[model samples]
Target: MARAPVLAAGGIVLRRQATPLIAVVRLRKRNEWVLPKGKLDDGETPRAAAEREVLEETGHEVSVHEFLGTLVYDSGGRCKVVHYWRMEAGDEPAYELMYDIKAVDWLPLEDALDRLSREHERAFLENVGPIALKAAALDGAARRKAAKPATRRPRRTVAPPPSVSEPDTVPAQFDAQVTQEEPRSTTEAAEPAISAPAAAESQIPPSFASDIEPVVIDAVPMRPSHASRRNLIQRVRDWLRRAA
Candidate 1:
């Protein structure tokens, strides 16, 4: 025959003062300080019952995070499994205690670890201790930051104070741009803005003749041929013989 397991829920509830403390409650009948855990009511979820139980037993409002596994042990003939969470307690529970809880006290987590009656509960604390410690440290840091006053940052300096000459030059340039007076019109009109080569070209005189020969190499007539010289000599000899 299989044994039916009893389901229960509770928390590792932490509250911070100078240092963070875990909430461990003393049981009236058992005369032991243990993490608060109880069997679920009809139609109650483990998480919901855990929250309700902590409120009822310890009188502290808690916001729970991380379902921190379970512990199962045989109680007499029946097996029992208890689920746990890492819960952060608020200012007030706003509810009255109504069960086996005699007193709930916040003690340093290390002390509470040692104080827990069950070895199983202490093992659970050991597993989740680092996470709880980190949360507490972060919470403490945030509170410190919030409480600290904000400081005003110093204004940035830019350009240094202007020199006397710099101020004088600025007005001179401004006056020259905005209301600059031109000198009285002179006999020589303002010179045209032209390149040096272009000005030289404009100064050159225009040529009238189109086919003029250059002074360096003049044109000349063709020289006499050898045939013309020989013909002239023969004509002279014939004329002299006839006259004699």
Candidate 2:
């Protein structure tokens, strides 16, 4: 009967920087430098195993992303299939390295390719390194774009509406006439002097004037007797006859 293949999982883990770096581990038993990977634990998924193995080997917490390709190779007369995912590590390590790993090295893609002990792992990294690097670079750019502050437009200054002038109340000619008049004294105001022509025009009629005879008026006025009143009336009748 044919034996089942040994299933393992790992990552192409990157530490974000100006130029990103990848993680590689030195094996304690074999003294060989290799990509971080391990066989799955009981009831553990491939993706979960990949995250756990990467954290254990690299001693840094990581965020796992899209899956890369798989690697099928023969190890000790058995088929070993390893799955890899793209992952990003934090700025600092969160835990100590596992007992199986002696030391961890962070390096650029070409150097990591040269340092890896196995021929298959190196070949796999070369094919997928550029893809992972590009993806990480895009992610970093997106984050920076989100963090940048937005520009604000300046406010407009509105000028106040033009002032309206009120119309004049009094006419120009009337105002000038009023301003030109001279002030009068108390004596002139009390007895106003009339012109000769005005006084002549205001005189009484000739008929009435002739009839007004000069009669002596006493200082103290007394009531006339009936006989004196009759005499006065007779004199008025005689005057009327003469005028006619």
Best by TM-score: 2
Residues 1-244, model 1: lDDT tens digits: 9877999999888886677888899999988888877899999999998988888878988888777778887787899999988788885667777778888888887898888888877888888877877866886689899999999899898989767565534567777876666554553344343133346444544452223332332333435666675554455444333322
Provide TM-scores for the models.
Answer: 0.60, 0.65
Please list the residue runs of candidate 2 whose C-alpha ends up more than 4 Å from where it truly belongs after superposition. 158-244
lDDT of each: 0.76, 0.87
Per the 3 Å backbone cut-off, how many clashing residue pairs does candidate 2 have? 0
Hey, what RMSD does candidate 1 come out at? 18.0
- Error (Å) of candidate 2 at residue 143 is 0.4
- Residue-by-residue lDDT tens digits, candidate 2, 6-81: 9999999999887789999999999999999999999999999999999999999999998998999999989999
